[model samples]
Structure formats: C-alpha cells, structure tokens
Target: MPEVARVVPLPHEVDPQPQRAEVTALLEGGLIRVRLPDGREWDAAWLQAGGSTSIELAAHDWVIVLPPAGGHPAVVMGRIGPSARPPRRHACASRRPRC
Candidate 1:
C-alpha cells in the first residue's frame, strides 16, 4: 500500500487578543528582541507548534506577543498584515485525526 501524507492546517487568523509588538532585534537561541507598544523591550521566545511547524521572524517584523505564563518569557504568537515581504507559513497542531 502507498503511504498517505497528512496535511495540517495553519492558523487562519492571528490571535484576537494578543499584545502587539515590534521585533527590535534578533537574538540567539531561538529568541527575538521585541518592543511593546509602551516602549518596553524584552527578549521573547517563539512559541513552538505542537508538531514540526515553525514560524520564521525577522527584524522589524510586526508580531503578536502573548503574555508569559508562570515565570516564562513572552511568546510570539503570530504576525500581522501589511508586511512588505512575503509572510512566512506556519502550522498549528490539531487533536483530530487526519481525514
């Protein structure tokens, strides 16, 4: 029998309630520096997808930042529109089996 490939869907829209931030700098160790709307800056980690999906972010990229849980750093949730460059693709993990 031939192997079947499963297709996972990407997030159709960004988080409705995520805090807006601008990528100030790109850092090492899968982290990026971001400046919040209030002018505060912090190094935040990218939220990992459940499977193998990864989102690529660059300097000056506008992204939605989610508040940190516990003592963890903030997570970059998704990107915003009106970007001059082509947006990167990302996938979200699903609990349902592939149909």
Candidate 2:
C-alpha cells in the first residue's frame, strides 16, 4: 500500500469526444501524462476546479489548477487500472517553443 496519489475527479471533460482507436493508440503511444499536485508538468488543455477557465465536466465536479501569474493547483494524470480500449480524445498539444 505505497503508491498513493489519487485525488480522483475527472472522469470526463475537455470535449470533442471520439477516442477509440485503441484509445488513440494509447494516447499516441505515450499512454497518457498529466501528473501534477506539486510535482509539476500538467501542461493543461482543460482542467478546471470551478467556474471560469471553463472546459466542461458537470456531474459532481471538483477540479483545480488555474496557474499563470504565480501558478498552482495540479494533479491531472490519468490511467488507474486495466483498459482494453474504450475512451480516448484528450488534448494539450501546445508546448513546442524551446528552440
């Protein structure tokens, strides 16, 4: 009982839903990546905790991390168990400015 980091809450959001090509090839062959919670590297595409900076995910909602100008609030990583392939369609592809 040692690998703990589950603030759970994000079963859906950041729409344009349509992900099942083997779950977008397991998130483009990298298999999801959004770990935050003070560990950094969220690279947001959509992960709000409450009104404003909205993306959409209503049904017992509770998100966080609105950073920028003294940023904070993290944790967005996914994949918590077995998945043969079903949902897919996630985002966040705008971090290519380090030439």
Candidate 3:
C-alpha cells in the first residue's frame, strides 16, 4: 500500500506590528541598513533563531523595523511577506507505526 502523509495543524499567525523600512544595504554579521519612511536611516540586525542563524536581506526589500527596548539595538523583524509559511511538522506527526 502507498504511504499516506499525515496532516499537521498549523499554528495561528500573529500580526506583525512595527514601522516599515526599505533595505538599503546588507552588511556583515547579519546586519542591514534601512531607510524609514520619514527618511531616517539606521543600521539594524536581522533576527535569527541561533548563533549560526543568518537571513539574507536584499536592497529595496520591505522589512518591519522594531525599535530598541531594554537596551537592545533596533531589530529588523523580517521581510514583509505576502503570506507566512506554516510551521514545520512535529516528529511524531510523521510516525505511522505509532498511530
């Protein structure tokens, strides 16, 4: 018999609330330069999940800029997406023998 894929539920999407900025340049160490709508430019770091995590930001890409709070540099949350990708499937969700 052919193996059937199990459907995993996706997490609810959270609304992104931040100022919009246009990427002007990609810098070393996951940093990026962005220009806000008001014409001010700032260096911001792209957020990642781990020490080795890196996300490439391109010039003219629209990103959400989060302001500094609690003594942290302004963060580039992520590039604005038409639609968010669903979360990855859980390990047990794909195990057929246990089901």
Candidate 4:
C-alpha cells in the first residue's frame, strides 16, 4: 500500500485569518491603510458601504479586516461597533483615570 503525502506549509508562509486593525489613513476612493495588531501596516479596501448610504470611516477607527487571498485584495469588513478610542489619561478635578 502506498502512503499519501500530507500537505504542509513552510515556516515562512502565513495562513490567512481575520484581524483587528486600526485605520491609519483614508486614501482616494474607498481605499485606506490600516495597522494590524502586530504593528504591520497594510493597504485595504473599504467594502462595507454602498452607493445609497455611505459609512463614514476615519483615521484612528478600529475595523475588522480580511487579509488578501487568492489574488483578492485585502478588505475591511466593518468597524468594531462604535469606534473606540484608545484609553487616555487625563488631568481632571474628578481624578478619574480616563476622564
């Protein structure tokens, strides 16, 4: 009996997966640049909104991104609900951490 060879990927190859990314800049058309969790930045296309109603995407917004695959470009699925800003420490009379 002949044994079947198992398919495997080399160490340098990465499996495509959904990633949370931060919008770094808005480009012409529906294109934008996003920063991944690992601090790597990539160009992605905004695909959530359509002609009739438009989604207002901006820099610093958190979004769900689908990595490029099979000749397809990297795409943004949508924002992570209401855009959340990074926690910031502020000087306030109330002495709150994120005032």
TM-score of each: 0.56, 0.16, 0.55, 0.58
lDDT (C-alpha, whole model) for all candidates: 0.70, 0.32, 0.72, 0.74
Report lDDT (Cα) of residue 24, candidate 2: 14
Model 1 Cα lDDT, one tens digit per residue, 1-99: 943544433344534356899998888786778998899887787765553254567788898887554445677877676635756555553455679
Tens-digit lDDT string for candidate 2 (6-62): 343433443333221111111332222343344444333233334433333332233
Which is superior by lDDT, 1 or 2? 1
lDDT by residue (16-35, candidate 3, tens digit) is: 34799999988876568889
Which residue pairs of candidate 3 clash?
A: none
2 against 3, candidate with superior TM-score? 3
- In order of listing, the candidates' clash counts read 0, 3, 0, 0
The lDDT of model 4 is 0.74
Off by over 4 Å in 2: 1-70, 85-99
Candidate 1 stretches greater than 4 Å from native: 1-17, 50-54, 82-99
For model 4, the stretches where C-alpha displacement exceeds 4 angstroms are: 1-14, 49-53, 83-99
TM-score of 4: 0.58
RMSD of 3: 14.4
Tens-digit lDDT string for candidate 4 (1-99): 944543333233546678999999998765779999899888887664444135677899898887765555578888877555768765574575665
- Model 2, position 5, has a per-residue lDDT of 42
